[model samples]
Target: MHFPVSGVDVFPLIPPAVAFAVSSVTACAGTSGAFLLLPFMVSVLGFTSPAVSPTNFIYNIVAIPGGLARYIREGRMAWPLTWVIILGTLPGVFAGAWIRICYLSDLKAFKLFVGLVLLYLGIRLLYESAGRYLKTREQTIALEKKFQERMRKIKSKTSTHLAAGIPAEAVVKNRLVSLRKIEYDFWGETFSFNTITIFILALVVGLVGGIYGIGGGTIIAPFCVSILGLPVYTVAGAALAGTFLTSIAGVVFYVVLAFTPLGMHNAFSPDWFLGVLFGFGGFWGTYCGACMQKFLPERLIRGVLGILVTILAASYVIQFLII
Candidate 1:
């Protein structure tokens, strides 16, 4: 079947499944598979249009919930962090939608903007992986090791189950004061970090995502884990929750922008049929990714995902400069 808006042929099971796989893997390190898929749509599928951005957002809308549900089931959702992220991200998405339609209609300029954003974010994540975050990950690992030993002792000693009243509460008792410091205690273990700095960082990440039609989790997740010294297990749900709300805002903003007077000659609107088609595949993929995420080691997960994202960033940079 031919998809009209982007002029790409839709194949059964193949396209959506490809989106699902990309999202499922990339999301492990807190990125929406949408970033990588955009290039695929343009270079491979020949679906290069402004509508592609919102269609990418549509993929997020479908793919994220499955993983989020898994996180909820595993008692890992961070409600407080989720709330802060959504509150900040929603308006920015709208502003970004406007900018894309009004000023960034030039694909070349937008490509450069997109390249620079990915380049900066990719380098930051790489730096964190190489050395800056090593000590923090070690400390977190030490604390987690201690916690696991305690859990093993309890499981062996007690027959109490969840119904027997084991409380697993996810609440933010302390406010993040600054980038150099944030502290949270969970399961009788205290974790501290520099949080104030990350808020500024998160904002910049959000803007890049806004411009490029992405969920901030892809960027925020690594910062939370490597730089802020938060556990990926807990942050995954929070980041997913944040991405969910922001995408909702992004879609609405794009739809509204489609009706307004913009620089473009064509009546710009998201191709709903195309978006939904991608979403159908992404939904199942996220479900599987989220479940597997719990079983995977944290270091392996981040290392693999970082390499993939860096490669994608490099591709975009090379394509932009070369073409």
Candidate 2:
């Protein structure tokens, strides 16, 4: 099928199939898989336009609600964290949309910058994952063992009536919220982060997301996990929620820009049909991923997140060098 706006031809089923596969895995780490999808659209489907960024946002807007709803239903939504991320990222995404059309539409240097940033984030995550494995081996092993025992019980014929995988203890409870700090409880442990720090990070991540069409979740999730000392279980929902809200703002901004003088030289509006197809696949994938997340150990999740980011970073760096 030919998508005139994107000027690409391929099987229509490919988009959703790829989206389903990508989102199912990435959603485990709080990403909507837009980062990976953008590359697929560019390198595989050959949709290289300013509009692609907004189209990426369209995917997030459509795809995120599935996992977001799952997170909420599981009581893992961190309202305070989500609010701060949205507040900080919304403005940055608007600014980024403008920058993408006006300055970065054809800039090779931008790719290097993004590649370096992602490389650093990827290394941070990998280092943190390794550190956790090396330093807390006993505790981590015990936790995983305990979790497996619980799962075994849940899987037994006698306990089949209980809710699957996600234990009631997985719920997130907001303990405190203030300008300087925010705290939450998950599975009997309390996690806290500085509000200003996260706000600033979200702002920067939003700017990049706006330019990249990733909704900032890809960048923010690892930061929350690796830097903020937050658990993957607790941060996943907030990160996805932040991405969803920002993507909505981003899509609207891009559409508005397409009609304005500033966007005259750029195709800022998304190809809605293509985005919808991808979203359709992503919806089910993310929902299933979220359902399975709690059943896996945090270290395994962190390792998966690290590997994905590292591979993406390598691809970007290689593309930069090739360019």
lDDT of 1 by residue, 89-156 (tens): 66667777666766776776676766666666667666655644666576566644654555556666
lDDT string, candidate 2, 1-323, tens digits: 99988888989999999999989988887888888788788778878788888888889989999999999998988889999989888898998887877778774755665567667767876776785543544434444556677778877857564434447666888889999999887766677899999999999988887887887877888888766767777788989999999999999998888899867776777999999999999999899888878877676766776787778878888998897
TM-score of 1: 0.82
Which stretches in model 1 have alpha-carbon errors above 4 Å?
143-183, 192-200
What would the TM-scores of all predictions be? 0.82, 0.90
